[model samples]
Structure formats: C-alpha cells, structure tokens
Target: MAMTPKELLNQLMQTEGAMCAALVDYNSGMLLESVGSGMDLELAAAGNTEVVRAKMKTMKSLGMQGTIEDILITLTHQYHIIRPVEKHDGLFIYYVLDRSRANLAMARRKVLEAESQTAI
Candidate 1:
C-alpha cells in the first residue's frame, strides 16, 4: 500500500542525517505538506520553485529529452535534494541533510524510496 505524503516524509526524516523535508508545488511555490525542520521550509520552497523552473527551462533549451530524476546540490555542511514526484506533475520533494552525518548513497536511495511510497 502507498503512504500519505506526511507519512512518506516522516519516514524520510528517520533516515540518517535528515534535517528537513517538504512536498512543494513548483508552479505556485507552495508547500503541500512538510516534515522535520532545520531551516525555513516556506522560504526554501519558494526559492526552490525557481530552481526547478530554471532547470526545466534549461533542459528544454538544450533539447534534453529525458526526465529529471533529481537535482543534488552539495554544500560544505549540507546536501539539498530536489526530486520531482513521478506521479504528481508540477510538484517536487525538497529534502535536506547534514553532510557530516549523512551517507550520501544511502540517503539518496532513501529519498527515492520515500518518493516511491508517497501517495501524493
């Protein structure tokens, strides 16, 4: 059975190094739902909306024909993830992790698994 968006996010936060996570609507820059906390999810959602749009636009301009699995932004202290929900158009998951605490490969897989279980 599929999990609710909240349940999925909750599961995601249980992964090692999870700092925060949110389900955001890229078009409106709104948080459909959110879980955990370290930074301002509202602000992050709005800012990331632009990031998603810019990536999509760039992909189109470049004639890229594939779907975006996820965008990873690595910082000195943190890792940011932007993953589009395959089942929900115009929506994406925003996730954060503490670099020093996270296992990148495992955390990334956790995000993918969480998205797979999410029911929107």
Candidate 2:
C-alpha cells in the first residue's frame, strides 16, 4: 500500500537513531508533515530548504548532470539527511538521526523506499 504523509513520518521514526523527520516542499519551504523525538521540525524544515537550494545552485553553476541522490550533514552528535523525492521532482525528505546509532547506508535505503511510496 502507498504510505500516507503521517505513515511515512511514523516509518521514519521507527528507523534506528532517528531524531526527527519531515516532508518538505523546497519550492515553497513548507513542511507537509513531520514526526519524531526531540527537535523543532518546523524550523528544521525551513532551514534545510535553504540547504537544498544552495547545493542545487552550486551544482548548476558547476554544470553537473543528473540529480542529487541525497545530502548528508554530519554534525558531532547527529546526522542530517536530505533526500529529494524523485517521483515528485521538487519535494524532499529531511531526517535527523543520532550519529552514534544510525546506519547511514540503511537509513538512506529506507528513505528511498519511503520516497517511492509517497504520493507527493
């Protein structure tokens, strides 16, 4: 079955070390929905939109081809992942996970899986 926005949020929370996650529209800087533990999801969603925009601009300036698979920001205590929704084109999923507990590869795969089932 396809996942609803809330169901996708819940799936993200189930991932090991997940702190927070949100579905964001980079074009409008709006969070469609969110879920997780300690974190201000609204602010994070807005900030990450900027992050995605900057990277995209840089890539364009450099004449890069294809699309971004994901952006990973490794903080001392947390890992922030920004995975763009390929199906929707301009939408994205932002996730924050505890670095010590997260499996980066697995988390990335899971996010991709979630993206595949998302409506928009």
Candidate 3:
C-alpha cells in the first residue's frame, strides 16, 4: 500500500539524525503534515516554499527544460532537503537532518523511495 502523508513524515523521521520532516505544497507554501525533533515545521515549510518558488522561477527564466528533483541547503551543523514529488506533481517533502549524525546520501535515497510510495 502507498504511504499516507503522515507515514511519509514518520519514515523521514526514522532517518539517522533526522531533525524534522514535512509535507509541503510549494504552490501555496503550506505544510500538509509533519514530524520531527527540532524547530517549528510550519515556519520552515513557509520559508522553503519561497526557496522552491525562486528556483522554479529561475529555471523558467533560464529556459531550463527539466523538472527539479530536490534542493539541498547545507548549514554548519545541519542539512535541509527539499524534494518535490513526481507523482503528486505539486507537492514536496522537506527533511532536516543533523549533519553530525545523518548519512546524507542515505537520507536522500530514502526520501526518494518514500516519495515514490506515498499517496496523496
């Protein structure tokens, strides 16, 4: 069975050193659901929506011909990932991780898997 939005958040939380996870609608910058250990996901969701929007706008202006897979923002001690879902078209997943303990490569792979199996 496909995972629910909440289940997707739960799975992201299971990633090593995961700090937070949220299902966001980039078009509206809204958080559909979330789970985690640090920060207010609602604010993060809203802020990241701008991030996605900016990139999309840039892509359009540049005449880029492909879809965005994800965006990674690396901080001194954390990694923030924004993954847009192909199946859902306009939805995205925001995953925050503690840099010291998270396996970024693995977390990214897992996020992709979860996105593929998630249901709207």
State the lDDT at 81 in candidate 2: 91
Q: What is the model-wide C-alpha lDDT for candidate 2? A: 0.89
Tens digits of per-residue lDDT for model 2 on 1-120?
A: 898878887898899999898999999889888888688888888899999999999999999998999999999999999999888877899999999999998898889898888764
Q: How high is the lDDT of residue 102 in model 3? A: 98
- Residue 90 of candidate 2: its Cα lDDT? 76
Q: Per-residue CA lDDT of candidate 1, range 15-112, in tens?
A: 89999999999989998899888889999999999999999999999999988899999999999999999989999999999999999899889989
Clashing pairs in 2: none
Task: TM-score for candidate 2, please give it.
Answer: 0.94
Candidate 1 steric clashes: 0
Q: Clash number for model 2?
A: 0
Tens digit per residue, CA lDDT, model 3, 1-120: 899999988988888899889999988888899887689888999999999999999999999999999999999999999999999877899999999999999999999999999989
Cα lDDT for residue 61, model 2?
Answer: 98
Residue 58 CA displacement from its true place in model 2, Å = 0.9
Write the candidate numbers in order of decreasing lDDT: 1, 3, 2
RMSD of each: 0.7, 1.1, 0.7
Clashes of each: 0, 0, 0
